[model samples]
Target: MGVMYRPPNSGQDQGHKMHHKIESACQKGKVTVIMGDFNMQVDWVNNAASGPKEREFIECLQEGVLEQLVMEPTREQAILDLVLCNEPDLIKDLKVREHFGGSDHNVVEFNLQFERKKVESDVKVLQLNKGNYRGMREELMKIDWEQSLVGKTVEQQWQEFLGVIEDTVQRFIPKKRKVIRGEIRQPWLTKEVGECIKAKEKAYNVAKSSGKSEDWEGYKNKPRITKREIRKERINYEGRLASNIRNDSKSFFKYIKNKREAKVDIGPLQNDAGNLVMGDQEIAEELNKYFASVFTVENMSNMPTIQESQGAESNMVAITKEKVLEKLRGLKIGKSLL
Candidate 1:
């Protein structure tokens, strides 16, 4: 989504430059939507543009395979606001009826045509936090591993142990159900704002068909009041979020996280197979393979110019459990923290 605002009467050069930038942007993105106040006085009925710059703008947009969706006048007699997309079917139900609070420009409401699959996790898991640890420990202690594993192979014994532990967990531990987190709601959206938006929509609908100047005047004044209310509500919302952040830090950080674009820590890397490795693990593996290829085995036969230490010529001994216990016994741990 590219947001743009070109000031009115800003020269033709600036318009050309902006169009060039938009063209460049369209070329890079798979699906692009450039929106906002372009301030172009276009004669959509006759398929004509007023100035040379507007004509060039339309030509440049077409060269880039872009489509301007807005046909109605967003501000008074000229269509200042515009919504453009590279793909023809990328934008759907493009409506220019409603006005946003505080702006003279009519709001362009539309939905991007796509399907986003919700990535749900597995259904059930152990809630260890609420588990009966004492009961589980007692149940485990009752199992005699020596006799249990006497006639079983290593793999069989492992399986048997796992089965017993699973049974114990089911008996003692509670289950947790994983669900998707709540969606990020707009911070500025309030009950008052919602009512105002509905009113603007209703007013716009009436003004479109009705010839009454009173109806047009009524619709025009709604936005100014709505904008003021929006500002107040937005400030209050932000203030509450700031003040209660310490108590509800998850929501605050989640909002922050949602605002920022997802970071690509590891970029696509080409592996030995000439295929792009996109995942973090795959990229790590590719890097590891590259690093492993550069490593050379050192020749032990030809040692470096250094003498071996001969100060302590004692032979090392094998470590036994008995020796470890004896060492522990010898320690003066009377005042040890542990």
Candidate 2:
């Protein structure tokens, strides 16, 4: 059975979960040959060779216990294709083959031999920190540690300060981990690449339109069809037409080549802030200002308001084990902290 587009919803965590499920199924006396376009690369490969997203996928596969068969030299050349087997020794001779399907991906073939054994259940439990210490350190460092609070009570300022620390640290925490098993049977294309292709097509159309208009305007009042003249005209027109077509084809392929080169640099593109948040820097600056604003107190007495609004409420609310667990799961799954 072929499965496709197994969602990487849990990111690395999902990879782990999928790994467990595959192992479980195989251990039950089933000779499982999991094959598909995983849409991921292995972590042992560099990001430049695998791309960041592919690298993350590779990390997931490693965490989940799946091994990659092909090792493409670069991420651009990296194949989304894969074939995995519970019985590796049986299909050690398998190799990739070319097909005439006109598809971007080539067909893969492998053989497998299965031998049942008493499978031992291994539970690898990892303990992770509940709080983001690096985030907490960064947030604490942002505070005006030497700022004086003349009017506010010590309790108020303390509360406000604590709130800032907690909020900043929480922002760095991961939210979920998911396990995904399957293949990308369909081609995995990014929007950026798609848009680039469209742009190239548009450019080609524009060139074609310009050429037609120029030809028509140049020969608008030419003589009506005469046997010899028509033949000559036909020859001239055909030559120009073929030239334009060649140029258009060249232009189109050039566009694609440029787009592919641009795609090779997509590692930094994944970290783009605009893609993740609206007005990223502005929002970050605004948040910093908001936190800074609360810390300022004209008098010691004024600190209570900041404290009450920020600190007191924070203290009243508690993060339960379920919430922490959820966060751990999220982190495992590849959720990013903003």
Candidate 3:
């Protein structure tokens, strides 16, 4: 069974083609059932006031030989609901059940003697040899350490480590197997961290202004500044300034607390049971575990080299074969026949 929402402005020919495709798919002994809010009336038996669009829709249904499964006439004078079947003969009974009372549309039900298709067994192919890691030491030695570490801070290095783990499971795991994953390269962090740093700097500036004001007031009534007094005031101001800087730095670090948390959140070292009670902490820990598992050197080891090759090949293909076929179909060949 398949369902779709077709818009009113989809055009007549397109609508006809959609019906044809469903019919063709069904005729291939698929026993397919297509139902949806078609957004058009198939008949005026229930709906007395019919427009050209509704009339056209009814004509199309007749042309396609779509069996109307529902016999109950709706109070709302629009044939927006539909049930189409390729193997109408297989259906023992069909009727529109009363609104179980919540939805605007009526529910249609059908009974059939149909056998469920057997699940196909998938053959697993082993591709990678465990022996490949024997040469991993050589590959690791060849990698440019300076190049890889460039632009990476302590925090970024930790994040990159987590990213490697997440990429592995997503890329290698079978689709049917359920697993949690995290998006590693979050661009939003750049903006979030930048804003946090700016806020911290602003607070530091405010604190500096307040300390300067205090110094100015203390010296306002003095006739001349003594060397000892000058040194003392300078020391006092510097101490206050240092304190402000420390506080600001602490706040900035706190803003990136999640990233710091992620660094220690995975594998045997994880503190999941303790962290789970704290929602934000738990999210950070989960993200850390996910990233740690996928974004490893082992998973993305050949990504840089493969991406370069694929990107170059993709650029060389002119217009792409897909686009060319689309252009060919767009040119009208038989408008008169329609």
Candidate 4:
């Protein structure tokens, strides 16, 4: 199903008509994929706080057992364009690309993987912090490194060192095999916001059952306030993170990259002769040749070698438990590095 030009001021009557069509289609029980410019935010996070059009759409989808796959915004900080499926479990790698040209909608892409035919792929997983690092260090301290190497040949010593390390690692850092699944969720979502959403849902139910003017008013006003609170919570959470960028630059940049999905890899390059260089080898050769021609060195015959300072002292400090704890405290809980 495709929708377009659903204006912002579209009345509830028009929304109902659209919802009826979708609901009718869903009642057929065929695998349904609804996509295009919805021009509506479904408010999936705070289920009850959606606008009238979105509310109707959500209700229709819920009745049809449909789930929206695209979470990120498709327009200016709003998920206007949507990709919804009745069987979300069958959908894999659902992604929303940046908007194309001047269109307000983004390019939505996904893969269909049948659950019945899904081949289980083994994944090696290990949690580094799950191991007793102190115990491992203590065990290593008991070993006589000098004596272990003294009477052995170079190859024998290498093999012995490798064996000891491998044994220790296997004993401490155990690996588990598991099957890959779906995408992970954002960490900043809070229980407080969730409770507020539930309250809004309750209010909506009260209004629907009672059908009183005051009850409807309360329902309308409560969700608006709850949405505002949710926005404020999100802003404050991100504000605190903005302050940590300088200290934890690696994590900060990683967070930005994930949020924006900003990995760029322009494959293949065309040379000046208009011949396309396809592979890495050909591309590298072309780049090297271009650079060699453009680069210049004055008085190359009398170039002098630069020497490093002999008196430089390293300012390296030992990583203590306190330092590690402080670092952990600085990072937001549940936030992943990737």
Residues 89-113 of candidate 1: C-alpha lDDT, one tens digit per residue: 8788888776665566777788888
Q: 1-338, model 4: which lDDT tens digit per residue?
A: 44435677888887778788788878897888777777776665666536566776777888988787777777757777777788777788887653343344556778877647766667777767688788899999999999889988876998899999989988888777775669875555688787877777677567657869898778666656677778888887777778886666676666677788566766589999998888976887788888899877679789899988899688997999999988888876435651
lDDT of 4: 0.74
Weakest 10 consecutive residues, lDDT, candidate 3? 219-228
lDDT of 3 by residue, 213-280 (tens): 66544433331223234445546644554566534555334435645645653333335466433366
Clashes of each: 0, 24, 13, 0
Candidate 4 stretches greater than 4 Å from native: 1-32, 35-116, 123-183, 302-338
Local accuracy of candidate 2 as per-residue lDDT tens digits, 1-338: 23434553447566666656655655656445667766654443442334565655554445445555654322235556676554456567565443213244544656555567975545333223665777667767776765744466766777777777557755755444443448642122334445543444444344335757664443222222222344555466445545665345554444346446444321212122444333655556556655787884678554554333444333377789999888776552222351
How high is the CA lDDT of each candidate model? Answer: 0.81, 0.51, 0.55, 0.74
TM accuracy, model 2: 0.26
Which scores higher on TM-score, 1 or 2?
Answer: 1
For all predictions, the C-alpha RMSD in Å is: 12.1, 25.8, 31.8, 13.9
| Per-prediction TM-score to the true structure, in the order listed | 0.53, 0.26, 0.31, 0.45
What 10-residue stretch in candidate 4 is worst by lDDT?
Answer: 97-106
Ranking by lDDT: 1, 4, 3, 2
**What's the lDDT for residue 67 in model 4?**
82
Candidate 1 Cα lDDT to native: 0.81
